[model samples]
Target chain A: MKLILLLFLGQVAPVEVRAFDTPYDAGGSITIIWEMDTAWVAKVSRIGIFRASAPGLQDSLIETLYKPDSVYVDNSAKDNVPYYYRIVVYSDDTLIAEGKTASAAVSTQQWFNGKRLSVLIILIIYTVFLLYFIMRARTNKNLYIRKIAGLEAIDEAVGRSTEMGRPIVYIMGLGYISDIPTVASLAILKRVAYKAAEYNAEVVVPCYDPIVMVAAQETVKEGFVEAGRPDLYKESDIYYLTSDQFGYAAGVDGIMMRQKPGAVFLQGYFYAESLILAETGHSIGAIQISGTTAVTQLPFFIASTDYTLIGEEMYAASAYLSRDALSLGTIKGEDYIKMILVVVILIGALMESAGIRILTDFFSIF
Target chain B: MTTIIWTWVAAFFTLAILSFLYKDNPLYKFAEHVYVGSSAAFTVLYVWVFDAYPKLVIGFKEKAGMQKYMLVIPLLLSLFIILRFIRPLSWLSRWSIAFTVGMAAGLGITGLTQGFLVPQVQASFLPLFVRGETVGQTVLLTMNNVIIVFGTIFTILYFYFSREHKGVLGVSSKVGVTILMLTFGASFGYTIMARISLLIGRIYFLLHNWLRLV
Candidate 1:
């Protein structure tokens, strides 16, 4: 019937239109796709989408899109309801040809996005690796982990401060508490605080975020408590500075100049002020140990600091320092996954070179 | 006259900050204190105007039904965080912290996986050779693809920590380090250029806008 109507309208090209529930979506949406020749596309000024509640019902023009759009998603469609759609081709605001779907499109909600199947698979495999090792860690205590110089130097940095009779300053950069790097920095700070408390030395932590300030205070207090020196923990040492980037840098530079800390730990996320802070620490004659995931700032830290934790090394600091069986196991699992990914990439590249798309097709979904 | 006065003030502050390059002086300290103090005040006002006022006060006024009532949860959470100053009620603040950490960790993992991990893996699937129209073009394309594919593989291998870097793994990781160092070198040069551009902007402001020497 749709074909007959198109023929009656003197349309030469066979009008094909489909309206269906969009896949890999949260639902209440129908996707309309139509085919048009490149030649016909030149004559089309706009395309109109018409929707009706039922077949043979008067459909209202829902949306008119510019030419070159072969697809349209109607997000306002009701779930589990059938929607009849018609595609009208217009030339200079005049309707030229139209196509209607032979069957209705129904929108329904999906529990899981099909497009994220690969991500789910990877997550499940990685989780399995973690869980297996975490459990196995109870028995297997001989996991061989490589040495990270930045983490290894923490004790030495703290000891240097103790010997010099100067406070150790730990800058948590400008990351809010929610950032992964900031959270990772908290773990490293706890270790530093513990060492400082053991040496009866002061550890000053100037925070960029208020919430991080509180967390740092608690972490320091915990470290002191663990060292059996809770009395040494000073709340004033872990304090909030301005959240403004340059303001924080200026404030920290001031602290470094006045206090003249023997050692400085620059950890977590940093921006333009990374060099300013590092350079200030250098001028103060402090031993600086820096770690961050910021690719751009790593060079500044590497250039100025005595030891630098590059990229993933910062994330692995806690696991490396603690040397807890479980943490080691997790690292082992991560390393294995990295190895697997390398293999996957190699095989993918080889296959792609040979004009095979098995792996490519599998991971092609956005 | 007002513009001139403000420009003079700005120039003085800028000069004061720059003087720190020579040594930390009283002028630098004075300028730094003013910057930090004003920044703190500005941050408080910014949060109230943009965050708390809009999300809470206006939400209570404008939002209807369930949404309006739901705002109470966030209000209570905010109070819990502020309750830390009371000492005795500091423990309550941990609840808010815990909620934020858990939510952030969960969101961070899923967000990174979807946005970074999958996209990166897909992008890395480059063909090792290309069939361009010319031999030179083909060779260039193939070389580029090989560099990308192997560069990515080796760099990833470098990050593996469970095993010691020795033998073949050591060589691969070494190559990775070399590549990473090269990248950092380029980044350093690029960032230095940006910093110089900023300095030029400040100098331009001093000369063109303030001093009017240009």
Candidate 2:
């Protein structure tokens, strides 16, 4: 039994270690190689690499390698700084063996260093413009903004549904409650529910995720409560159908067919099911307003829906719905930065076309 | 003759699908049903050949060496998934639901930590400046590396929740959020531009390739 225990320990031991020159990129990196013992082949766990400034100093754990591989490259060392490296091997819960330290000093690479100059200039310019806008917006400067037609039409959509004596259907697309896009969707939900409560119209929300269904229920309840019509909120209206993407689409299609809602609102992230849902709403002669950041689904929505909020417009919906100052400020800052970008692009293009290298050079000094 | 036949078939299917944009008619409905049926059949065949046969059945036979009995569990589980047909037995599908949810949660947590958190933290911790041979290098760090490292640190702090953002960190994080928003907006604009370009390309194709127009 003692001999068998010894054999097991030996079989699980860390493999031989060798230091090799780091290749391809630069001399700043060092590569270490090892061999895994056969007995722990499938079960052998991650390798950990530790680095130290000096031989006698305590080594700081630099990185953990999860792959069951025999090689690791330490790329964190700086130029002219003497460094020591070590590796720890593991099998399941057992630390099988640890390798000895290897020392090296990182050397500089000129070509790689020079290639990054243009990138630095671009970043600096972007950062400056971003800071400028943030400061300007903070001071509460008057900013001209165009009205978003979809946001302006929200009241009209809800009012029409109330007048027609038909329900307003709110479909939260296949996005998790935690995602920023879904948060925006919920914000819109609150607004729609509030309008529905005031107008005394039925609001129906069918969800794809259980968590989102719960959040939607809470948001709608809050909206009704805030509108002083808490009695009008129905829990059954906010319900989960299925997590399956297409299955939820089919269910919503059936709901649209049966109920014939006067207004349909599609918000949050959607995929292939977007067109099917939008087309179904269109067929029913409902006023369809859709918003999503999913670029692929945007075209289909635009072609089929009455109004479609394109990309960042969806992000701006929460602000438009709530009139939140922070969100409005962010949007204004975004516009300013966009203007700066247009100027830079035009200048860069003109300089390149005119063969004036100095303009490009001067621009690079950001 | 072969080219002509293939062109006609392609045109028919294209017209059928495109007709849905105008209104849902019988031709569009037929095309839609055909598409759905073909997709479902393809999915079943794919899962059986790629996922089920190899990963579950053959995997159990090779790795666990419990072939016949293990296969029984999966076969029953699959049948349970189809239990939606019966009203009473539908609740039996909870076993598969629980198993899938538990496994997915475990895998998602592992992937989130590995793919996002750890790498991002490590990437952010890289040194701002490295010694170079020239004075330009000493004056400024590598541009791409600087932006990546800077972006990572500020973005992380932008999501920090320990204290109210009021001081230097708050101001910096506010700036960071602005940068992030602008980048997102710019990327969105570029993406729309690319899509519009593609739409133009498709229109060009239809006019030039299908109709033989210049």
* Candidate 1 error regions (>4 Å): A1-13, A93-96, B61-69
List chain A TM-scores, every candidate, in order. 0.94, 0.64
lDDT, candidate 2, A46-134, per-residue tens: 78888888889998889887767888777765655667777887665677667777654344444443333444444455456556655
Error of 2 at A49 (Å): 20
Model 2 chain A TM-score equals 0.64
Error of 1 at B55 (Å): 1.7
Give the DockQ-based CAPRI class for model 1: medium
Cα error of candidate 2 at position B168, Å: 39
> Residue A97 lDDT in model 2?
64
Share of real contacts kept by model 1?
A: 0.79
lDDT score at residue A186, model 2, on the 0-100 scale: 81
Clashing pairs in 2: A120-B143
Cα lDDT tens digits for candidate 1, B9-54: 9999999999999989999999999999999999999999999999
